[model samples]
Target: MTTVSVPSQSRLLNRELSSVEFYARVLELAEDDGLPLLERVKFAAIFAQFLDEFFMIRVAGLLELDEADLGVRSADGLTPAQALGAIRERIGQLLTRQAKLWKRGLRPALSDAGLDVATLEECSDKEREKLAKYFEREIFPILTPLAVGPGQPFPYVSGLSMSLGVIASDPASDEERFARVKVPEGLDRFVPVGKRLVPLEAVISHFLPMLFTGMEITERALFRVTRDADFEVSDDADDLLEAVESELRRRRFGDVVRLELSSSASQAMHARLVDGLGVKANQVYEVEGLLDQADLSQLVAHHRPELKHEQWAPVVPPRWARVKTAGGVFDEIRRGDLLVHQPYQSYRASFEAFAQAASRDPDVIAIKTTVYRTSDESALVSSLIECAEEGKQSVCLVELKARFDERRNIEWSRAMEQAGVHVVHGFPDLKIHAKMTLVVRREADGLRRYVHIGTGNYNASTARLYEDMGLFTADEEIAADVADLFNYVTGFGRPQQFRKLLVAPFTMRDRLVEEIRRVADAAAEGRHARIRLKLNALVDPTVIDELYAASAAGVPIEIQARSICMLRPGVKKLSETIRVTSIVGRFLEHSRVYWFESGDESCVFLGSADLMPRNLDRRIE
Candidate 1:
């Protein structure tokens, strides 16, 4: 067998691209005549939302890393300062592209479709009159203008809040003054005055003069700020829950990582804002169109299905109604193995069925599950509450530090605790990442355990958008392994061996490495060997190195990663046999699937794991 080596410079993908360039390309692709108009609008909206999350998490994380003086370099070989600089440069370009998309591409296409996002200047006389009345009745009551002067300090700017900075002169004294008014979240981001929709910032900017009757309005511009939202938990904290709550409080007061001002902002005003927010000039972004594009999601609900992808209703599993009517989902599991593909198949039918079964089954002795992110109206949580009400043994390991969902998880934790559900925060350090549900039942032979393992969260709402996979099995070995995993999470037991399951923080990574080595050895022996991995990210250096080694030994590797792939594919002498591609479309690729060709035999494993360092090294079962 001939082994091939990949050259370093032959890598296919860059470590990171300018977000501005990335989005500009997205807009460019969206405007292609080959794509549908509605699809283009959806792409535009998605690009905006992606930018919001990038600011919230990635930018926030980088700021925190710099503040803590961690001095850790990213996989792309850039320091925090360099990363921020690159991000700023990229965002400026993206903002320009966003303006172009709105002003040229989407606006015209929307007009053709009879849906226009009109500005105050573009409104007709009758429309203006209607807007005036609507503003007086609806928007005026919610306005709170904060004056920045000697007696007042800068107001606390909430994360992602769009506000207007008004420069006004007193009619009597002719002294310049600045006032800020945040667009209220309770109000719609897009105010529909007549048939046309207007941005709330535009509406507020137009009516600023009316609010200050005695003042001469000189200038006004829209601005927004992104704050550090990443939470850090102390290892020695007395109570994890209390520590998380305190951290959540501090998240609001975190150092500002970004300040987005209108391009027309005066130099003095920009300097004042930079000083007030304690951010550098490079951190400032001048947006032309909407300050926050995430709010464009509101326009997605304009009852214009023609402006978006066709609605996709999830398919009900064949056994769903049968299991639900049988008063227990475990009965079906006991009879046969079940497979579920999300978005195409419903998560409510699978997860809700587990909870519903646990709540009603008298023979079921215990129920245990791990929860990371759930909606405000979670069917899974509701079922758990029902189990507690029914006096069934229900234990939930709710991870309070699930990033953006911390506050919601805290509220859920309190609610679960109040409902008599034994809610534990899992290990103090490790996050419980494995998605599993254990149901202990009294069987004819003895105690039997049924388990459900999945590649995604137990959340029903996200199932419609995120593509994932789940397996329901009553196999004693796998069920026993799941029981051991639950015990390891909630108690002090660690299984020394697993028959069919791969768990992190123990043997998952090692097992994967071993499997890759086996394929490499077989390839070296002139047998066919291949590996396919589909994941959200690929950042673990160890895993990347192993894959590279396998590639050197003639093993073909195919990877489909949705975002943030550290490993560069198609590099000569390094990863010549490896190919990586990302698919972003109607459904978010969330499943982590690994398929290995073992010459004469093949194996597949699906679970809640990504090839990230934190997931492999720090997270628990």
Candidate 2:
């Protein structure tokens, strides 16, 4: 077993200071005048989304640790209990920044942009009458009001779902009452109030009297709950698919980790919710604006082109265009290997075109690919269905547990099956993270295999928005390895060694470790050595320690991680030679590129794997 050495306690920074200070710095940057106005709003939205996920996954995970009676200490020497306490304190401060942005920043800027988010008090009498009529016609029918009292139990609050809390008094008994009304998911999070936008919660609050009829309505507030959404599968399961299905079913019932309430919630109402949800007082958060700002993404799509960034269509490489124009897409592949950089270069011209060609070609024997994500109107999926309908073999290994994409993958798998395509739900315990496609063609000479290896998903929609790399090769060895990988995903045929491919859950992690060691050895021998890694995240402690060791040995390291990097850069002696920078722009930086320099021998590898424990050790290739 390869084990990474844990650094001494003295090396760890103060947990509260490290996490809280970084959050404060992010808030400072968000409020900085140097950034563009719209970009500042974007940053605020990004921070809110980030915090939402943190509550959903990280906070939930820590709560699970507490539930399991796990006493493991984090790298920073904080126990689960201590970590939760620290997170609550830090998150509270972060929420304060978010509230300030909404009140002091976004509201003013939005007003300047001629878009006003009106509160109930800000509405005219005619506008209020219009809202009341709209609420009665559309919203009243969808709401389910649940009373909490001696006869009624506390209602179950679904994860991230918003609700209106009503405080009413029974006209007969003069007893104080509490009732919860869940805002219908079908309704838009923000409804148009005349020319401006008003959050659905605010709209619902205005019509609370309609729901609780004959009761003296005293007060009303909005609240939401966020539960643990992470799915875990048992390793010893006899049937992987069954285990995954079961876990997916249970994900809805996970413990609540966060309860977001209106800042003006009464003390009685807060206490009742905290007890009802079985959540700690510290897990509760108070916000002045909308509970879930993720819905703001809808507002961002105003069709007002001038308010948004300029759209840039991905360019089609000359070679690809020539193939498409010449009516011979395969000729381009036959000539030589083609490399594509997505967003900058078109993915449909290459990957989607290959699938379409396979579907139309009579001599094509089989088409196989692993799908992690796809759009609703996926051209690649349509082509695969066409292949099946044309009496050609079409195999798809669909990962059903591709976070937040499970439902879509399930639907796609069913559609593929109905189309006579071989649909394989991947192993329950291990997610197949490889992005590959294989096509077998019967040619005049013999059989030929064309393969595509990408550093991102096959989803054309994401391809246009995510920075990724894809390689189209007719190389026999690479094609054979891809065949092996596909077979391994669809069946039980595991290849022990791969030619020109490093597969995770087998050799990828070991290969990375060995490469780092080689660089370290070269540095020790007075030879030039360096490593550059660009990834979306870096959380696996083994990789982090390896980079730390490399840094200690004087090997320069540059890392570009978009989110959740565990390694602390610029630490004296510990990581002095390591530099890290993250870039967030129009395109999501999704490609993972690893480059090493050992005495002028430069090597580069791109793949779909991140340096995370699940990707490295648990997920299948």
Maximum-lDDT candidate: 2
TM-score of 2: 0.93
Q: What does the lDDT read for residue 502 in candidate 1? A: 87
The digit string of per-residue lDDT tens for model 2 on 54-98 reads 777777878878778777877667888888887777777778877
Cα lDDT for residue 62, candidate 2? 80
lDDT of 2 at 517: 83
Error of 1 at 586 (Å): 0.3
RMSD of 2: 2.9
| TM-scores for every predicted model | 0.93, 0.93
Worst 10 residues of 2 by lDDT: 10-19
